[model samples]
Target chain A: MTTTNRQVRLAARPAGEPRDTDWQHVEEPVGEPADGEFLVQVMYLSIDPAMRGWMNAGRSYIRPVEIGEVMRAGAVGRVTASRHPGFAVGDHVSGTFGVQEFCLSDGRGVTKVDPAAAPLPTYLGTLGMSGLTAYFGLIDIGRPEPGQTVVVSGAAGAVGSIVGQIAKILGCRVVGIAGGERKCRMVVEEFGFDAAIDYQSEDVRKALREHAPDGVDVYFDNVGGDILDAVLLRLARGARVVICGAVSQYNSTRPQGPANYMSLLVNRASMTGMVVFDYADRYAEGVARLAEWRAEGRLTSLEDVVPGGVAAFPETLMRLFRGANHGKLVLEVAGGKGTGTVIGEGGSR
Target chain B: MTTTNRQVRLAARPAGEPRDTDWQHVEEPVGEPADGEFLVQVMYLSIDPAMRGWMNAGRSYIRPVEIGEVMRAGAVGRVTASRHPGFAVGDHVSGTFGVQEFCLSDGRGVTKVDPAAAPLPTYLGTLGMSGLTAYFGLIDIGRPEPGQTVVVSGAAGAVGSIVGQIAKILGCRVVGIAGGERKCRMVVEEFGFDAAIDYQSEDVRKALREHAPDGVDVYFDNVGGDILDAVLLRLARGARVVICGAVSQYNSTRPQGPANYMSLLVNRASMTGMVVFDYADRYAEGVARLAEWRAEGRLTSLEDVVPGGVAAFPETLMRLFRGANHGKLVLEVAGGKGTGTVIGEGGSR
Candidate 1:
């Protein structure tokens, strides 16, 4: 068992995009599990757009990570020691374990998973927070009906890729909006989207006109800015806009709103915001369904795991802003090898 | 009977805030009604912020008024000649009669109202589109429950005054936001709002924090700009924002989007757009309920009627943008005696 735990802590808030200097790496003696507490060796840490929001200080859906605190992250880890009845040694578990080599927890929000059933990294991607978010945001807020055109922003990313698949499974025509041609191609071929819009090269509104000629019925938005404005213009009557994340605006000093939001009035549509924590009670149902689809060869998850473990968290997180990494970006702390799946890099599965 | 009909036609589309050069006055011969047609002598024209939207050349809920065409308007008039089964001479009717003294109609979108039961101007105010807009937008879209806090921008305007009253009738506490001290006082005293915020003088966000300590449950927005942003930041969990109109943005070449719209996600709230015309089938239901409330003295309609015939329409319409009108703005083409109601000055009934 490891006696030293390496952790990443926030040194300062970023003005725009996060920089390496804003975080500090720390080495600490591994914490021992007290009575009713369990110790975990974190295998992988989830890198998400939400982490940027967590770094900010203000009113948010969740509390901001205080300066000098371990930067918040969702991770899948194995129990190294157990003093709690709910957790045991060798059991794979998922929780808000921060960017650390090990975590000591008392079983609050910690859920057990079977690594034999799915890959350790898959538990942090398709079967973890991303799956639950896409499930609830799409099914509850998006409410896409069969034959509806469902457009997803951040189409090559974690939650968005799964959102498109689930939308297709529900009999929707899925169109994904991504940064480049390669990611767009992977969104179509690997994620099973009907069409993909390369927002970098093409005009989103004109592209939407060709792909979704009838207008978008359900728009699951992750990156908010001009793209959100573009989708607002082509919304079908009584359309639903699910505000999932604003990754594009998260780094902007002046966040751009959907300028054409009046289209909601013109189309009699609705824009609703969704937060995954609101669906905590239904996580089991979401996991069961997602797991079932995966086991049946209907759902697929891709993990872009980076090396360097905990200390590399700050740099790997910046990749999301630069659109450098694809699929569910995760840092493999315990894998000790180049083990992330490469599915979204053009024609590759 | 008048042989000549004075008309105001659109000469050019306004770049911003509509200048006098954008319109042209014309004297045309009164046409005789043919088979299945009727003639209407327009009495009062409804002056609304929506008029500004109709001048813009783009896709909207309704088509823009074409240049050289008589500017579109909702008017209450008395039928003079009728060759149709649904209409008779001297019958009071309401329709989009334009800024003209005479209207030749085939009775497609016209509805008859009793001028004897109410005043001629009331049909264009509380009993017309203004009343129906307030009814449906408040009840159907806002959906305020008992004891909930309802915030309304443009609180002293036609639709807003009635919206506050309807929200009050639904057993909710209402806070109104309007420009100027007199308008603010009128919103509280005449409109019976629980509180009023003068956006011209007071800080809207700080005022909201004081007035709506528990946060706003329903926000009926008319003047959407910084005020919408302010209210957005104070929304309670599961709040609903009914976008009735963006009077502030209608005149701008570059309309401002609500920068704080992401607050919808933090509160798990929704922002929905409401167009009064969508509730056309339910107009009778809305009017009936509004009339009942007025009859019971629980509701009051204020008409900021301007004296001067149809030729004064261009100038009279500007009153809405200037916030010069206290109540429902009406361009009186035939009310030669300056008989418009005097309310909403301050501390008046």
Candidate 2:
């Protein structure tokens, strides 16, 4: 039997902001699984700002996604056919399954997810890569001690939201910097952040000074550029700045660097950049803890799923760049049948 | 009986390079100790690049040296008159006694030095602040592991010289970047550095690339600016760059920063600045390790002493800025002494 799969392919490299011509939706036949492979029907696809970096043809922590290849992404799906020993036919699996309706996997770096534990879309958010990135970057790289002031940028977004919550769990005074007032409120109310700064309404530097009077001990930087510059000025002595992602500058033609980095000298601070893939061997440990937190009702997972045919992939993913998504943005490819109900405000499934 | 003492005071803050007009020499009658204070006869005065930063009218890791005050410096001296219980007459001690022939101390942050263990100048160099700065900055900040490739800038200077040697002891492949060929040769032969790059004669980037072909794992940066930019381009993943001092930009009217800092993101590395004074509580740990290395004949201490009266303090201290001194530069205040033989190029003591 032949299965039809709609895939998003990279048609051209984007200079600054990605346009319609940059991506192409191609319909292809999904073949049967080979000897050692399994066939998966894609249920939810993770849309991340890191996708912009993968479009560029340069060396980074990870290799860029090649041209004409199904646009690389993380997805949670149900296995339809299995020839692999570890995976069953009805098992829920997540991996680099690309932006497609169906995926064939050889079981390399693929993991099974439980629907009863939480929503299936959450496996792509809180209990997935975004959650693991926040955990290791804050806990291991930042190393925030108890009672230390922890500041997080992009605080309303998926990774930043989890990072702020983890800092709070570590007994730190948590402050967040988000784009709007609504997002700021969500950061404080949902994530248990002590204070929030709306970057659009308030002057970040002034708000930071008022909130973090003793200066920031750990800055979990997700949006680099001017926000990073503002945080640099408010860093306390021996501060650790963890650079997880630079979403604000990822789509810029010319990336703007921090102007006042010399503050690192006066503050005797350190700025470290980390890629979550580097901690791949220990990802299970982070996922286990995050799942436990969710089970205990200590951590709330937010996922915004847009339900439509696979043709809506480009526009759905663009919502993240426009700051339209308040949580982990996921595209639902299989409709509402097998996929669970969407519970959040922006969710439609 | 009245004793005359000579002191060098900061006349004014210099604009770019400090001139002779920036200092004033004054002679005053040395008073006797009060209740607990002791009078120290200054012998060896340390002249460091960090002194330039102290003269600037801005906040730093430490407070700026005040105008019209005695020029600040670390000095090794003998207690000529004592009333303090911790110190006795004829005891050798080291502290921030300034550029003076005598200092009155109540034993705050002052430590006794055994001249018989090593020369009095050795206490100001290998056994004192410079040695401790190198020890902690390399091991604690740089975190060089065994078999890692470690690079050190200003490698022939006081702190950098010791940093390269300590990295060697940790089983790291040590590379030194120095100004002249003579200093480069001395760094390899005396400090046991694996290789030395003549930054003055050769292209810094090319030489660094050749010396550290596999990329630098730990970079102990004493000279920042362009050398830091050169090292940034060749950093390995998870590399640690320790900023101990910025000697290259110390005298600049407007300090220039490294342009290639984006390499930190690409390499997933960290750059941290450190001040040795912050590790004051653990200074004895550094001193003991350095002393043990010296005793085992594995580490050699180099001191270049300029023999003159306290009136020559201004000119003697300028040798550091000019890079005229090959090793730890110290001023020997002339007074009642035995044969004042200026020994050149000998082992420790």
lDDT of 1 by residue, A117-167 (tens): 998889888999999999999999999999999999999999999999999
Chain A vs. native, model 2, TM-score: 0.95
What DockQ do you compute for every candidate structure?
A: 0.68, 0.36
**Per-residue lDDT of candidate 1, residues B138-169 (tens digit):** 89998899999999999999999999999999
CA deviation > 4 Å runs, candidate 2: A1-4, A11-27, A57-59, A88-90, A251-269, A306-324, A335-349, B1-4, B10-27, B56-59, B85-89, B201-203, B251-269, B306-325, B335-349
Q: What is candidate 2's TM-score against the reference?
A: 0.86
Classify candidate 1 by CAPRI docking class: medium
Give the alpha-carbon lDDT of every model. 0.89, 0.85
Which DockQ value does candidate 2 get? Answer: 0.36
Q: Rounded to one decimal, what is candidate 1's iRMSD?
A: 0.8
Q: Please give the lDDT score for candidate 2.
A: 0.85
